[model samples]
Target: MNRQNKISPFLIIVACGLVLLYLHGCTRVRPLPGPAKPPTKAPAKKTEKPRPYKVMGKWYQPLPHARGFKQKGIASWYGKKFHGRKTSNGEIYNMYGVTAAHKTLPLGTYVRVRNLKNNKKIDVRINDRGPFVRGRIIDLSYGAAKKMGIVGAGTAPVEVTALGRPMAGKSAAATVPAYMPVDFYSGNFTIQVGAFSNPDNAEKLKRKLSRIYKNAHVVNDLHEKTAPFKVRVGACSTLDQAAKYETRLIQNGFPDAFIIAE
Candidate 1:
């Protein structure tokens, strides 16, 4: 045994410590920042606004002197499919009868319809609402077109004249009718100079009333339980004008003259 070959226990322990240090250096784990912070809530999205429709054209009524009341467009007739159905006026639709549909005009309105191509004319009651398709002005029932001699062509050039009154069954002899009364909500009012039991009497009074007022019209209240016929004059824009007319009516033999707000 040589003295150089002999090793002390403390020297062996020192060698083991150096080996452990080398292993730790080879397998070192890098220090990482704290776990990633959860993403902060994002701000809420903004809301959107609504859009409006484009109006193609303005609406108007064919005036009394609008002789060229002619509007050229597609004319269509509704038939059996719509028969027996309730019209916009709440009346049962009879396609076999002479009736028509109009937009804007009041339900139960009366209109004089003429087929320009055939020179045929007919009185049609507007019981429903329509001709909703763009460019078309009136929708006539099957019977109405046949009366106007337009069924053969299916569609024809036409002219429409608004009647002086509503379309319900009361005869022209009744009191004045309100075609398009000034809205009562607007505080507009009118007065009747006379009430007639006969249409001829009403017509005579109408002529006289027409001379005094620009908006004079005849109206029939078919829905009324009594006094079905009534004639109304001047849709005064103000209560004072209506009262003035009422005074004139009283002086002219309508002793019971009263104001009618429409």
Candidate 2:
């Protein structure tokens, strides 16, 4: 009987120990509430219409509404110096690509250029602004110039007609404008040595050039209040004379020098 009593006490002690262990295991540590999520940022709104911009003292208004624009005037080509540079439209210029610059056309416009002298046609996308010189209506890329057979002559009389809006993310096709060609005004001949935003810098260049050339001066932009100051030499009587002077300027380290008709 005494042995039975001792075994019962030992069984009771074992049961109590198991119960304590079970209670301890049932108590779980809940992970602290996760950190609050961060707030999301709103997406930026996109601009649909481009704003007017000024360059070299001239304000160029982008024509987003004008379609089927057609004009006839002198067309010039730019190469090497502008290759790989950022165009007015924020695109990297590729001289070999079929692209052109128009002073007032909206960026991403497609146009058809036909060289009247050679009867060659080329379709180019407008991705920049230029031909800032008077009387020039368009500036073609090296590839476009070569395709239209104007590389040899440097400049040619051409008909430029706007095609529809450029095909988004794809190559644009040439389209003929239904409207008649509009004639552009012709300007007098001058040799542009340089264009500067600062009048002081322009004056400095003009003074420096005056030492070599008798007729050197700074011309303020007629349209804009604070536009580019143009340093030009020679109010040459004819385009041929201006061209000869341009050649001389180019030979004398002014590679960007070109004839501008004012």
Which of the numbered candidates is closest to the native, going by highest TM-score? 2
Q: For candidate 1, lDDT tens digit of each residue in 1-262? A: 6667779899999999999999999999989889999999999986321111112342222111211122445567888889999987798988898889875454555667877777787777777777767778899999988887777777777887666354356574445543432121234566654455666776776777788667777777555445445677778766557668878877877665566655
Model 1 quality (TM-score):
0.40
* TM-score per candidate, chains pooled: 0.40, 0.48
Per-residue lDDT of model 2, residues 1-262, tens digit only: 4555355788999999999999888896777999998888788886454445566765444543434468899999999999999998899999999999998776776688999998898778889998899999999999999999889989999998876564445434435423222212222567777778889999999989999987898888765456468888988655457668888998999877766655
- RMSD for each of the candidates: 22.2, 14.1
- Which regions of candidate 2 deviate over 4 angstroms? 1-49, 167-262
lDDT for each of the candidates?
Answer: 0.65, 0.77
lDDT of 1 at 217: 73
Quickly count the clashes in candidate 2: 3
